[model samples]
Target: MKHVLAIGAALVLAAGVANAEEECLEVGSPVGAFYVADVTGPSAGTKLCYRCKFKDRPVVSIFAREVNDQVAGLVKQVDGVVGQNQDQKMAAFVVLLTDEPESAEGQLKTVAEKHGIQNTPLTTFDGVAGPASYKLPKDADVTVMMWVDGQLKVNESLKFGELSDSKVSAVLGDTEKILN
Candidate 1:
């Protein structure tokens, strides 16, 4: 009876901790945040957020679908490094923001022609805080984000501090709202 009681107590405690973590938007793995976006499908591999800690461990993977071949290819590449919890099994398209509004608009139209995605712009006017918007297929699974550097980027700025120009790579600052 005592053992059973102890097990029950442990389970309760575990559940509480899990709940707390789920609600703790800021506290999550190095990969994209679990509670950030409405991620669906297979799962993304290990992703690295800017504010992630060294000891962070991945817990979930978000795999969006409906993107073009380019988007799917990017997702597969990124997920490959996410290790165990990677949601690579998932597939999808992702809208990508451009380095600049004009270029983004153009690319959206071009990519759409080949991939059949409709481009949409996020038109950022926050003045050095947000990125100008570009549109892609609404169902794209690739993680479309912005690069404050304008028009083009050498790398995807997953971490906030990496923004050299007053650019934002995506709709989110961190994993905080990506899962929404």
Candidate 2:
């Protein structure tokens, strides 16, 4: 009976370890990719704080706080892509601001109207709420898109592969144990 109980306990622990690993694989990081796991204060201001491993390269990260000041920051980020390659926009910006989801969606639509970002070659879905998803670009397999989930009331993306929820919660969670 003692041996049987020990075996059962071992199996349970093994299952738990497997689940924990699965939790991180949902979104799928690239080979040799790793996230910063933690950082100091947010970068700019909009809650973008993340440091993700991106396969064989030094870990890559984005600072959300920097986004609170959107106009200059967005321009710089998108333009940074252009500057780096000087051809196509290197990254796509998915702006998620506003204290409320409705307001955030409204702003996206408004910006699309005024700035003509609607349904263009690059610009896909407008600001709809909840369960929002997008496909990975062929080249953007290396990049990540960040947005707000007003329903779950968190920030997440399809980019992080398996780490999406936890990573997002780290950004939005009220818990003390977060990277930054």
Candidate 3:
């Protein structure tokens, strides 16, 4: 009886892990248009659709619930990548999901300036749940979706406390998938 119970528990745990690893946006899905308030981008102080603006270009879109050090680090690295890939028209943006978009705007600006983030735009979506179409999981603290020529190539979701240094490196490496 004990052995059976242990096996059942292990199977349950493995199933949970598998579900978490599943991509939020299935690979190869068409990237859709969604408008966010551009806080620190070329179109600052306006609501715009980055997906529309960067159509058919390689893009790295990050949605984060909060701007912590790890999230900031990821954005900074992505900013560098965008700058390097300008010739390829690679673009990236960070969308902060919050109920209080007014308050989040200031913090987004600070993070951009502090990190000297010049290439990627830091924008805000006016809800914690994010765009209805994206279907961002409530438990996901950070979700990264990359696309090339309007088709998603990578979708990675990281829960709170899961965005470690190695994970950031792995995410940056995924940029190559889209860039190519």
Candidate 4:
């Protein structure tokens, strides 16, 4: 029974490792520019490349398939962080990846207003796959990438139902890695 339990534990651990390794954009990788239609923020209704705008600044980019309560809460928290770190030129944006960009824009706008998300722009990509360069995993419901000087410092991928409060806090904490 003990040997059997050990094998089961090893399998579970291996599965977790595999999932972690599947995250989009490895650390230290260069982040390229990608355009998304800005639903809310300074450039509302315009398609723009946030990467180009925030060049060399510490940035947190979130790509999510759907907007849920958890995602809204995460965005709100990230917005607050961005507001507090303006002196550091820390920036962040949320990209909603959907097949229907038009409807996604409305949903993003609603989330921004409801959550008072002033610092983070809520944007939408054309499809659920996200930008071709991103190579976002099909199983990933949300992918958060933080970079400084255009080099990625942190990359986290969470599947549906995986974005808990603790996970949000962990992601926020990792922002320090790029802020320097």
The numbered model that scores best in lDDT is: 3
The per-residue C-alpha lDDT of model 3 at residue 35 equals 92
lDDT of each residue in 1-180, candidate 3, tens digit only: 999999999999999988865626688888889999999999999999999999999999999999988899999999999999999999999999999999988899999999999999999999999987776777899999999999989988888589998999999999999976
Report, for every candidate in turn, its global Cα lDDT versus the true structure. Answer: 0.29, 0.30, 0.92, 0.91
Output candidate 2 Cα RMSD. 14.8
Q: Please tell me which model should have the higher TM-score, number 1 or number 2.
A: 2
Q: Which ten residues in a row have the lowest lDDT in candidate 1?
A: 118-127
Q: Cα-based RMSD of the predictions, in order?
A: 17.8, 14.8, 3.4, 4.7
Task: Write one digit per residue (lDDT tens) for candidate 1, span 1-180.
Answer: 999999999999999888654532232222221111112222222222211221122111212222345343333433333232234221112323332433343433454344332211112111222211222223323323322111111123233233223333232222222221
Instruction: Evaluate model 4: give its TM-score.
Output: 0.87
Candidate 2 C-alpha lDDT tens digits along 130-149 = 11232222222122332221
Provide TM-scores for the models. Answer: 0.22, 0.29, 0.87, 0.87
TM-score for candidate 3, residues paired by index:
0.87
Ranking by lDDT: 3, 4, 2, 1
